[model samples]
Target: MSMRSPYPDVEIPEVSLTEFLFADGFGDRADAPAFLDGTTGDQLTFTEFHGLVEKIAGGLAARGIGKGDVVALFAPNLPQWAALFHGILRANATVTSANSMYTGGELAHQLTDSGATTLITVSPFLDRALAGATEAGLSADAVLTIDKAEGHDSLADLVSSGAPAPELTTTADDTAVLPYSSGTTGLAKGVILTHRNLVANLLQVHVMGSVTDQTKIMAFLPFFHIYGMTVMMNQGLHTRATVVTMPKFDLEQFLSITQKYAVDRLYIAPPVAVALAKHPIVDSYDLSCVKTIFSGAAPLDGELGRAVAKRLNCTVLQGYGMTELSPVSHCMPDDRGDLDLNSSGFALPNIECKLVDPESGKEVGVGERGELWVKGPNVMVGYLNNSDATDATKDADGYLHTGDIAVVDDEGVYSIVDRVKELIKYKGYQVPPAELEALLLTHDKIADTAVIGVKDAEGEEVPKAFVVKQASGADLTEDDVMAFVAEKVAPHKKVRVVEFIEQIPKSASGKILRKDLRARETEQA
Candidate 1:
């Protein structure tokens, strides 16, 4: 049977993201700080930030990039990135976020797959972006940098242009963001999140967390990722929260910024929680300003969550979501005194969840493990250009199969037990085994290869490769195999462990028997 959320339904506005965020005179409050650079102490008030967004949109329209165009945004967390992101939406264009750490080959795939017409990046990432854009058939003029470079137009030029704002003609169903995901299986595909999908999720989490204009948050999570894009950046803006932006995660910098800003609500991943629980450096900084820590994008052990909560004397909670759900479907209640650290929390308003047996395709009763199926207004329209995948993920009844094995208790709290998919969770970032295996095949010494996630010393899942070396490649070492894969992918996708096996077990249909490998690992342990 399907389970519905216990909370009352909320009215989700059928308007553009920009309209929903600045609705009912929220934008008129010009004196409130919207975004702050953690390191530089630069701040942007609400009026200034909104003005820049419109100016950038006008500039892009004058450059022949208006409605229905796809723009690739490849930058770290910064005040300018936020302006540009909304600017694209203002022009009725879709923004596809590119991971900041991607290599040339990896970036090219996303650019080509998303059919991006223009690329926006910072000066430091210009070389890779230019190369990837060129490979994806975009011209040099199509590449724009946030900082002034020798041959590229800077973001300042765009903002300073006196071009008139293009007429707004956006619909709630129009695609807003095209964040890619390796859902359930295979290579990355664009997850088409429309304006309504995002707005609904923003309101869902806002009411659940009781977020308001007074909330202070940190933007240490990368804006390119969905969790950060929706939870921290968009929700924080919608609620008029003071956001302390960081380009990347540095423990000392995070603590210092939290202390400096008196940040109350912190959105983090499981790895940071691990550091907060075990690292002595956490004791050095004043974290008393932090009232709540919401961890997502990966699983957090119960003991680790309690340890951090105990030390900080604050609420440490967990949420569960995927890219297709606008990144949040369930979150813990903000006011609860007694917390179940292991439970992911209740389904948000307007969301319905069910646990179904993977093999039988039948819904299971509560307290039993089954693949999670969620239905909500926040669900994606579909995977772009992949009808088969879209059909496989969402059922005829409209539920999206999450591929995460979960169990729900009598209190309606959900806890993830295991993943039904082959995707690895490397500190909350997805590391698809198929992508790594395809990369491994390109190495000259590799005759055959299969990749799987193995538990590391810290009990975290990391990519491990089992390879069959060619007769002439007898001298190939584990380091050589790892180095070859690292050059073409991001840091998190690198192979950490290598084992030589004569053969990779596969079924007659040419599917890798990952279950066999997992069984062997368990047997060895």
Candidate 2:
């Protein structure tokens, strides 16, 4: 049986995302800062932001980029990134946001796959951007920069075109953004999220968060990820909050910015939570202004969440979603801080979820674990140009098979336990790697860790841990590491193998890159 959200459904506007965001025209908050650069202290007021959006739209239209055309945005989080994003949409074009950490070849895949005719990026990333454009069969003329470059048109050049903004022709059903994702298991494929998906997620999240125009939200997560695109950037715009942008994460800088801006709401990944909880530099800053720290992207350990909340004297919340769900489906409400920090709270309004036993293909009752399937307005239409992949993930009934195993309590709160593909099996017993990884993180000597299923000499699959030890823990032995986890977990879930690494490989969004670790093991084999 599919379970509905405990919260009442919120009305999803039929207009485009831009229409839904800018319809009221800023009202009395026109002069308020919409985006603030945390590094340089530069800002764009709501009025200026809207004007830049129009200018960017006009510039894009002048370049023959309009309805159905796709433009690639390959830049870091900046106030201009937000403007250019809206500008592309305003011109009735779709935006394919590429990961900032992507290599030239990696970016070429997205450009060619999304059929992006133009690429926009900053001057510093010109090398990779130009290389990607060239590899994707695009001329240098197709490349533009956010800042001035020797031979390229800049965002300023776009605004100087003086062309009138095109009329809004996009509807809620039109594709708004194409963010690539590997989904449950596979190589990355473009996820087709429509205007309705974006708008619905914004409205759905609005009912669960405490953000307001007066709230100062810190956005360090990459805007290219759907989590930041919807939960941070667009949500800030929707609520008229001032978002402080960080191009990247730096420990001391993050703390300083939080202090400088008196930022109240922080949206981060679990890795950032680790730094907040364990880093000594955090003690030097005054984070009293911070009221909440919301974590997503990967499962946040409950103990880590509690540590950060206690140390910062603030509320810490977690959410569960994937790229296909506009990246937000379940989250703890601001007022519900009393709930378990481990659970991802209730489903957002208008969502229906079912937990089905993977092997049995039967829906599980509350408290039983199964793969989570979601249906909602925020769910993606499908994978772009990959019907087989789409059909494999999303069923005929509109339910998206998330492939993440989860359990629900009688209260309807959901806790994501593990990914179906990532779970380790030991002697016919299922072992969730996340549970072991989370347990390992609680050890003082372990800075970071990743757990994966590796075959032993007997050809039996067993759990192995790749650990990054703290600087002070150089003398800590592998036996000590295994023993630490062994004492807490069942025999089937023991970390049978341990390898000390300098760092655990992670994606920009903070998910453990288990495939990379597995490849390393394969190379050795």
RMSD of each: 1.1, 10.2
Backbone clash count, each prediction separately:
0, 0
Global lDDT of each model?
0.90, 0.90
Provide the clash count, candidate 1: 0
Q: How well is each residue in 61-152 modelled by candidate 2, as lDDT tens digits?
A: 99999999999999999999999999999999999999886668668989999999999999888988988899999999999999999899
Residue 491 local lDDT, model 2: 61
Candidate 2 stretches with Cα past 4 Å from truth are 422-525
lDDT of 1 at 77: 97
Write down the TM-score of every candidate.
0.98, 0.83
Model 2 whole-model lDDT (C-alpha atoms): 0.90
lDDT digits (tens) for residues 306-392 of candidate 1: 999999988988889999999899888887536687878999999999999999988898899999999999999999999999999
Residue runs of model 1 more than 4 Å from their true location after superposition: none
Error of 1 at 353 (Å): 1.2
